[model samples]
Target: MFIDASTNSLTVSHRPTNAPSGLIESLKQYPTANVGDAMDRLNLMDTGIASQWANGRCVGPALTVLTREGDNLAIHRALDDAEPGDVLVINALGGTTRAVFGDLLAEICLAKGIAGVIIDGLTRDRAAIKELGLPVWARGVSPAGPAKYGPGAVSVPVACGGTVVNPGDLITADDDGVAVIPVERAQSVLSRLADIDKFEEDLRVRIRNSAVHAAAPAMASTN
Candidate 1:
């Protein structure tokens, strides 16, 4: 497909549909930090994408978009073409001066049932976005708007948040941050996260019990 550079026309291919089912639900049981710990056990580095949500979490397969700095034509195309439960993982080359998305586009994503947006650039309309309750993770927020003109591609592998995101890769984000699990590694990562969750829970209980035991001696001495 040919894109018109003059118009910033976008050519989008179908997003991959083979994401593992139930993994997203399973991931939701743990925080992004726990998930990151699990990925670390496998030597996967942090995604480095900051979570911008006023509330709630985001979990889904990625629909990758690669665009020129300060341009978001491909992002608009990705929104139109992405399936439900797909996170629009955008690589804007780490441009921080211009916001690639705003409240208006976020409304479109909500209406279309997009899981969330993770931009490696900037976003605007922070107040409205928080009110609207859309999960948005980005490098920063800028009031400067992006140009529609683009040299970009949709549904292609892109470097986002200091990580390489391929279409259909599992994207999980929350108050902590975002993490990308490769499509081929989702199952193993999920299993590891489960183990981590259990370990953390046990540690929490042990710490509480020890604290109680330590305080019991002081209480008895006072009596």
Candidate 2:
């Protein structure tokens, strides 16, 4: 996504995953597109890690999972320790040969009130995942299943979708893609987002007015 699934060890590191007070609420008001704009496009996951369902959006602190190439035992372990509103961000090493997640895991996340998932590798059960309405962004899907062996770590920084995601980073994802904001920088990012919002709103007004202006001459000539 490997080291052979047969040879992988397990490591777990627990750390604080809480974002700044009001940070989640502030972030919820913006989309990943706008957030990316605010960050000068430096904060986004790669375009390939896209939403598994239409209209899926999520904002929460990440609970990072670093797994051996083709195994997901660490993902299961991460789920056991997840807090409400945590987004399980797994670095599966980009191996798409097997699907490391599916509907059952989606169900578990939903039941546990976890925010969503982002995988650097692949997943399965596209239809069922959509049916459950769990927000997921992954490289793609595979019908093949994953190995459930240890040799993975939870709450540690790992690479995902061409970026390194640290545990407790604010993960904002949508149909457009995913963005990871370090918790320490979230409030600053929020302020920047407001400036971007204003700028975009002004641009949108101008864009719409230009459309109306462009159509007027045609309407006048037709009349």
Candidate 3:
């Protein structure tokens, strides 16, 4: 469970056998819902730091990144150490002053099999990112540059888009919003989400039939 401080790498001993199935399926149900609802159910913050460039939904495992102000050495390091099917979670101190990612970063991530990037910071090269068809969730866009300073970490716990993302956790993002499911509780939450989805579907059916009541019945009716 220990990660190398210098290398910022750790062999994940406990891989979720489910392959992030539950929420992934839930996304199918509410194709237009934001990923933030699921995150709120899991007690996550809505960092308001994301935007979609790709057309479809986004779902994958997390690769957390923490960096000092205007510095992305750790982010660069994380990418080098990134594995396939990873979602890069960047904790950029909520700084919208400079872009932490751009066309080059998006290109690198796509080539490495990274699912997406969710950053609590700014990003540039908007046209290029959109052109590349990469999924990026960030606070905003800026043309400012980042510093190559010290004090940063990767593959560790980080807060992005108002969620606490631990390395190897599951992240599912879409036009709805971004949601983070803990690797430990993913299955259970997914089950609950399924039930919610079913109930909502039934409700929709009733509404379509004009069978839904406008208000509660009178107290006398309870008798």
Candidate 4:
């Protein structure tokens, strides 16, 4: 895709090299918690960026977008180049007073086959977005609208919910929150997920077999 060089605002960066086919499906099998464990919890997005609807979960390559706080012209532009199953991982500087995008944009994501969106800023129209079944994780929602200005970039490295997201980084998100897995770490994380799953299952078995408070771990993040 051509990056439009005509304007100082609304710049574009190169897209990421694609990951293996079916990678998103493989990552989807594990929940965010297991993904976090596999990465030593260092790449997980902050808990503040949470699901806007119940039962929301998705995994896809990041199409990173960076915009000024409370603005979304670049977000609309990013969709033009989005491939099916791409997830828009947007960094909006965590602005809360106004929304960067809302249900109207989400409908576009659905039409484009985009997997979902994770925003470091806010959005409105939660009810309508929930009805659309387009997964969205954001800091919060506000009724306020956003400015439609440029000065943002698409397909660039961006920070969302405290995690540095590069284009093509795998975004694994669910009820628990989002985890970012750089392409380089994808294999290592996949390798460790099984061990984390097994250890967790074994602990569940232990808790089930025992009948006392002591059956639980001294400290556990599993609850």
Please write out the lDDT profile of model 3 over residues 41-94, one tens digit for every residue.
554547475565656456777888888756666677777767777888888999
Off by over 4 Å in 1: 1-11, 41-48
CA shift of 91, model 3, Å: 0.2
- Among residues 3 or more apart in sequence or in different chains, the pairs in candidate 4 whose N, CA or C atoms overlap within 3 Å are none
Which stretches of candidate 4 lie above 4 Å from their native place? Answer: 1-8, 211-223
RMSD of 1: 3.0
Please give the distance, in angstroms, between residue 1's alpha carbon in candidate 1 and its true position after superposition.
Answer: 16
Question: lDDT tens digits, residues 1-223, model 1?
Answer: 1223353466666677857567777776777777778777332224455766656688898889988889988887777676778888899998988999899889888888888888888999988988998899988898999888887899888888667888898888887777888888888888887788788889999999999999999999998
Better of 3 and 4 by TM-score: 4
Candidate 2: segments with Cα more than 4 A from true spot: 1-8, 213-223
lDDT of each: 0.80, 0.87, 0.69, 0.87
* Order of candidate numbers by TM-score, starting with the best: 2, 1, 4, 3
- Leading candidate by lDDT: 4
Model 4: what TM-score? 0.88
The number of residue pairs in model 3 that clash at the backbone is 13
> What does the lDDT read for residue 131 in candidate 3?
85
TM-scores, all models, native as reference: 0.90, 0.91, 0.77, 0.88
Which model, 2 or 3, shows the larger TM-score?
Answer: 2
Predict model 4's lDDT versus the native. Answer: 0.87
Candidate 2, poorest ten consecutive residues by summed lDDT:
1-10
